[model samples]
Target chain A: MRLITTYLIGLVFGVGISISGMANPAKVLNFFDVAGIWDPSLGFVMGGALIVTFIGYRYVLKRPTPMLSQTFHLPGRRDLDLPLIGGSAVFGIGWGIAGFCPGGALPALGTGSVDVWIFVAALLAGIVIANIIQAAMARTTQATA
Target chain B: MIETVFTPFQSLFGGALIGLAAVLLMATVGRVMGAAGILSGLLQPQDFQDWSWRAAALVGMISGPAALMLVTGEFPAVQVPVSTTMLVIGGVIVGIGVKFGAGCTSGHGVCGMARLSPRSIAATTTFMLTTGLTVYVIRHILGT
Candidate 1:
């Protein structure tokens, strides 16, 4: 039951991304290219999602616990830090260059494009490398402490 | 120089569905529906239960085109004008950045922003600015 719910949720997200035309890198890039042939459609997508999510989160959080979980797994961090800003900036540059953020990229994989495969393979490698770097940093902090 | 036509109706509907998906994830799994975070978790899963759902979500995402095909009678367009080298470089940068930043579009942009989290707000703003600047430099300044 839990797995089914999760799968369905993913499906809904995938369908949403497809229907919104966000699965297309060209469309996404256009949104970022203000000086070029700009498209504000992506903004509407974000706005619509934000409005529904803002309301949905409120209602869902009011419950004592989630339907299938004992606790809400929300992020607890509130402090603004360099990693957050710097990392996001880097991510943005990549996004602008490729016009394929994870959300868009994941759904696009279904299109059977070799380029998507290449990007995803590279993304996985990057994720693994980042994990290694993060682990090393943690160990160094532990050693100093 | 290709034109991207406006799609307000479809965008809104799709956005709402995505929002609903997030809500469903929260309601059941009690987890935020961040795309990169979910995929990242799959790389180093803590347990079976954890791994199973991530796999399911990914499978669903990958098969999403089939779903769309069923509904619309054609696969959604996926234009990749970026070269292979750029795609790899961009993918790696995005992977590392998302890891350090702790979220991506679905996580920080949609879910986090909805929650009114300051960190997410900052992250979103910073990324948005950099994304715009990067595009401007690439398209306008560099004229690539």
Candidate 2:
């Protein structure tokens, strides 16, 4: 039951991404290209998604526990950290260069494009590297303590 | 360059669908539906229960285009404007950024923002600024 719900959730999200034309890297890049022939479609996409999610989350959170899990897995950190800001900046630079956020890119993988595969491979490598860096940081903090 | 088309209707409808997906995930699994986070979690799952759903989600994500094709009578279109080297560089940066930032567009921009999280708001703002500037520098200054 949990697995089925999870799969359907993903399918709905993927379909949404496809219908929004976000599966196309050029469309995403054009949304960023303000001075050029800018497309406000992505903005509308975000806005629309925000409206629904904003309302939906409020209701969903009202329940004491979710149907399939013991507790909600929301991020609890409230502090603004260097990693958050710096990482986002770096991610933005890459996004502008390639026009693929993980959300949009995941669905694009279905396109079977060699380019998409190459990008995803690098993305996976980056995740591994970041994990290593984070582990080392934790170790250093522990040693200092 | 592929012509940039405005799609207000389709964008809004699709966005709503994405939101519904998020809501559904939250209602059932009690988890935020962040794509990068899901991918990473899939990579390093704590248990079979953890691994199963993430894998299913990814498979569903991959199958999205097929669903779209069924409705639209053609596969959704896509184009890569950058070279292979650029794609790899961008992918790596995005991956690292997503990990360190703790979320990508779906996680931070959509879910976190919906929850009115200060961290997510900050993260979203930071990335939006850089992405715009980077594109300006590349398209205008460098004329790429």
Candidate 3:
């Protein structure tokens, strides 16, 4: 039941992304190219999404539990950590260079583009490397303490 | 220097759908809709119990676009201005960054901001600023 609901939601999300031009790399790139030919369309997309989500979260959190799950699985951390800032900066550079974020890239696979395949493969490799680095960092911390 | 056409109506309509999708996920499944987090979970599976929903969501994401193509008889036009090597490098960087940051545009930008998470707000700001700078350097300064 939960899986079905999540699937349906994902479906809608995918469709929304497709229709909103979020799935287009050029569109995304334009959003970041402020000094260049900047397109403010993505701003509206973000605004529209934020407004709906802001209201939705407010109403949903008031309930004891979500409709299907026992509790809302929201992020709990609030610290301004180095990883968060540094990682986001790095991600932004990549986003600007390639014009593909995780959300945009994933749905784009449907288009069967070779470049998308290259990006996705490289993305997976990077994730694997990140995991390895994280594990090493953890081990070092454990050994030190 | 490049003239580009903007689609305000399409963006708003699509963005509203994205938000509605997020709301539906939260209201029904009790999960925050983070695309990077969802993809990462599918990558590094630790347990089977949660895999079902994650997989379902991923399948839905992929198929949703596929369905649109089938219905509209047109695929969304996409252009990657960078070279293949640049694309690969960018992809790797994005993968690593999202993993380290624990979220991406969807997780931090949309959902995180909605919840008013301080961490997400900071992350989103950092990325947006960085992206702007990066584009300026690449497009204007480097002229690439």
Reference contacts preserved by each model: 0.81, 0.83, 0.82
Better of 1 and 2 by DockQ: 2
Please rank every candidate by lDDT, starting with the best.
2, 1, 3
Residues A45-104 of candidate 1: C-alpha lDDT, one tens digit per residue:
898889999999999999999999889999999999988998899889888887889998
Q: TM per model? A: 0.98, 0.98, 0.96
Q: What is the interface RMSD of each candidate, in Å?
A: 0.9, 0.8, 1.5
Predicted complex 3: CAPRI docking category: medium
Span of ten consecutive residues with least summed lDDT in model 2 chain B = B1-10
Each model's number of backbone clashes? Answer: 0, 0, 0
Greater-lDDT candidate between 1 and 3? 1
- The global C-alpha lDDT for each of the candidates, from Candidate 1 onward, is 0.90, 0.90, 0.86
Give the per-residue lDDT digits (tens) of candidate 2, residues A1-145.
Answer: 8888888889999999999988888889899888997988999889989999999999999999999999998889899989999998888888888889999989878878788888889999989999999999999999999
- Runs of candidate 3 with Cα error greater than 4 angstroms are B1-3
The candidate 1 chain A region of ten consecutive residues with least summed lDDT is A120-129
Candidate 1: tens digits of C-alpha lDDT, residues B29-119? 9999999999999989999999999989888888888898997899888887678898999999999899989999899999999999999
- Can you write out model 2's per-residue Cα lDDT over B77-124, one digit (the tens) per residue? 888888888899999999899999988899999999999999999999
